[model samples]
Target: YYAEMTLVPVLNYLDIVGTVKRHLLGPRARNQVDMDFYFKGSAFYLADLYTGMSKVVFLCFWYASIIPAVYFLTAATLMVHYISYKFAILRSYRAGPKLGAELAIFGRVYIFPLAVFFLFMQADYNWSSFPFDNVCETNSTKVTDSYIGSHNLQYEYRDKDGGETNFLDNIKYPVEISEGDSYFKFCNQDMYNHSPKVFPAFPFFQDDESKWMSDDQAVFSWVFSILVIVVLTLVVNSILVRRLGASILSYFKASYKPQAITINQRFSEQSEISAYVPMKCDPSFLFPLLLCDISDIDTELIGWEDARNKYDSHNLSTDVIDEMKEDNEDAKCYCILKHFPPKKND
Candidate 1:
């Protein structure tokens, strides 16, 4: 999977699509093609390449616990992405789009947390289900040495005939087992012959009674991993949005640059007037957009009601007139804002 992702893109660098197209359409079609076809570089898209990189990176991290060598594959994938992208951009593709750290920011803010979580969960699962006869035994010195949480015992698989039992290595954590949850009352001579559920703690739960009796480690590993990932993801993204501030819209460089140039061009000739007679707050809070649909639940808890007002419930005709007037209005209110230069505009 990793090799294909890194190598297949090189085919684009060689323009296999073009070769197949030219050959399939016959030699006559090649002569009739556009004059710029041979001279112009193939139209390469950076966004697709970046997306593939993120996917393969996430894949590697997800499976690295099972196969440690996947880490090396991830490095190779990144190297190929960088080398092929830079080389193709220079030698074959047309000028790529001017951009900022948006894609880089996306991978950081979204993919890394998810990938890390999968890595942790897989590692935990491997330890929990380790097939070898491992862990502290009840009769061993390790059990008497530490806290109950630190000590665990696994069932022996050897039988009387000297045959191998090969039992699953499940840790037996010391916990209170009352008559209702006791192993002898629930377990039978043939407990292993049939399904584990026929034994006690049969509330049809995944574990016999609960995970402690069967596999205590499986359930907690993935759930806590998710919660940890959630907290970290929230903290990182919160920092991102907070730093962006109200100028988030300014990152729309394709739209922003032209407007900035036109505004500067128009205002260059006008010198002063204290920026016109009226400089008001624009009643920003009363705008329809600010009148968000807040639920009573939110109002009771968050106490945003002092600011929120219900839109007028006037007749349909009134709303129609309001909508028409809104559409007809040809004025824009400026907030004396400044525009920043787009990153790496070339």
Candidate 2:
């Protein structure tokens, strides 16, 4: 059970990678196993998504009560990703973009936190079931001992037959119980006390279970930790995707520079124009194209020095800028406000 919980994700990931390679590289590479690229990509990603969802459901075996808010949120996230990828595959997504490399990347990155999440879930579920045994009897001299209490009793394992064995050197803490009629026998160590009254003590002697965390606390801690990881993953991925997409678009934009210049030259010949740089001009001049659906303010315009100058002259209150930043840390509003100081003329 322990090994399964630990190893299943790794195995699944390997399978997904193998499937992706086969799908992209063709049958000859994978021992004559032919598979469609779209089919393989969708299948593997959907499988991972299913496995993640199943892990959430698997937690129910340990916690049958009302599900934690985190559980619902996590499950919903997995579902959303599944639906999105499936929708893309069925409708809009093209396998030629990266030949299933994108799926493999997502599968590799997502499985890490997912694996950790399951580990926490399994550990939380089986926490109470951990092997523990209380000391039946002990005869050490001191009032408190390491295993039991300090008292004058020597401990030994007694068998069913009239034979006793003292293998104290071999045994470690948290002693393992042997099979058959094996029982612990404690003899009085103190010569003065001929008839010693041994006390039934605990295995690990310190009697404060209060120091341990309750199930609710453990659940919340685990859930909260997983939640933090999920949030960070989302935020970081969003930033990376945004930046990478921007770079790619920029490269493509550079590629069209010559064509744009040629079109502008033709337009200038037909009509009098001051600036013939179509790509560099304001978007309004370009056409009605929406790069971002955020208000009328183009996100690209935010990068323009002229627009930033205009914004600075507006003299928007610090409270307003602070409020925007407070609303969304990743909005980039804070960064724009920070870098573009308000015009002194205002």
Candidate 3:
């Protein structure tokens, strides 16, 4: 919406004006000085200025968009980890290993596709013919005459209206003459034989053919640059995510052991230790205990003594049963049948 409202209009205006100037007025306008020079110069100057300004604007847009995009992606990733730690630690803990392996495999697989997408977006695929060289010719003519007569006096030729005529038309020279006579000496003989000739040497000439031939190279360069940028961004982003995930996982692992230890200590002191001395049992073992009225246990024929014998006879600790009894002797003891220790052989 922002682009449509602000940027697109400006870009369209620039495109329209640029197309008109480049295609319509650029070729037809002659390089002649006149009262219109100021207007023409101002127009061209404004166009050049706008072209440079547009480039800066485009660059700013790219920078603005890319920086925020990268930052948002990074921030969102961190936020996800934070939320995982806060309310979803169990899932987060399990997800770390699986996500890490997937990222490693997918990062390698998608690198080339990312590069190609970038290249296609930035590349110009239009094909047109260009000129290599051009030749232009202009022609003019001059007339001269050959004469064998000797002139007594040199006189300037004039037209009937007394206008000066070119004297070279009246001049004459012998095609073949024997040398050694002063009277037949050459007088301005070399001047009549010379014709004005112009030979221009122009280097670095290119026409439509050259432009057409080079267009593909230009397009290839643009595509290649875009590909390079995309590949770099992808690889860098993948590395960053991989590192971030590892860091989060490490922090979770580092915090887990301490928390587990604290829970173990609390449970042990409250229920496992018969007295101050630690019992000969696995500190890590988990158990379930049941609570009921003493009447219910006697009615079911599963008395406290029976339950204790059922679990403790197999060498498993019945801490819950003892803890419940200590808390209330008259309170009945119910067994967590699912967690009951296996029967012992007599």
Candidate 3: C-alpha RMSD after superposition: 32.2
Task: Name the candidate that leads on lDDT.
Answer: 1
* Model 3 per-residue lDDT tens digits across residues 19-94: 4545567666575222222222112222332343333334333333224453344344344433433332232111
Per-residue accuracy of model 2 over 39-143 as CA lDDT, tens digit each:
344223344555655565555433432344555655555555455555555543323222446655654455544555554444433332222222223332333
Candidate 3's TM-score reads 0.17
Query: What ordering of candidates by lDDT runs from best to worst?
Result: 1, 2, 3
Cα deviation at 267, candidate 3, in Å, is: 32
Q: Going through the candidates in order, what is the number of backbone clashes in each? A: 1, 14, 11
Q: What would the TM-score be for candidate 2 when compared with the true structure?
A: 0.21
Task: Report how far off residue 332 is in candidate 3 (Å).
Answer: 50
- lDDT of model 1 at residue 179? 31
Question: Candidate 2: minimum summed lDDT over ten consecutive residues — where?
Answer: 197-206
lDDT of 1 by residue, 120-228 (tens): 6555444333332322222223322223333345677778899987655776755542332212222222222335433221223333332222345445544544554
Candidate that beats the other on TM-score, 1 or 2, i.e. the better one? 1
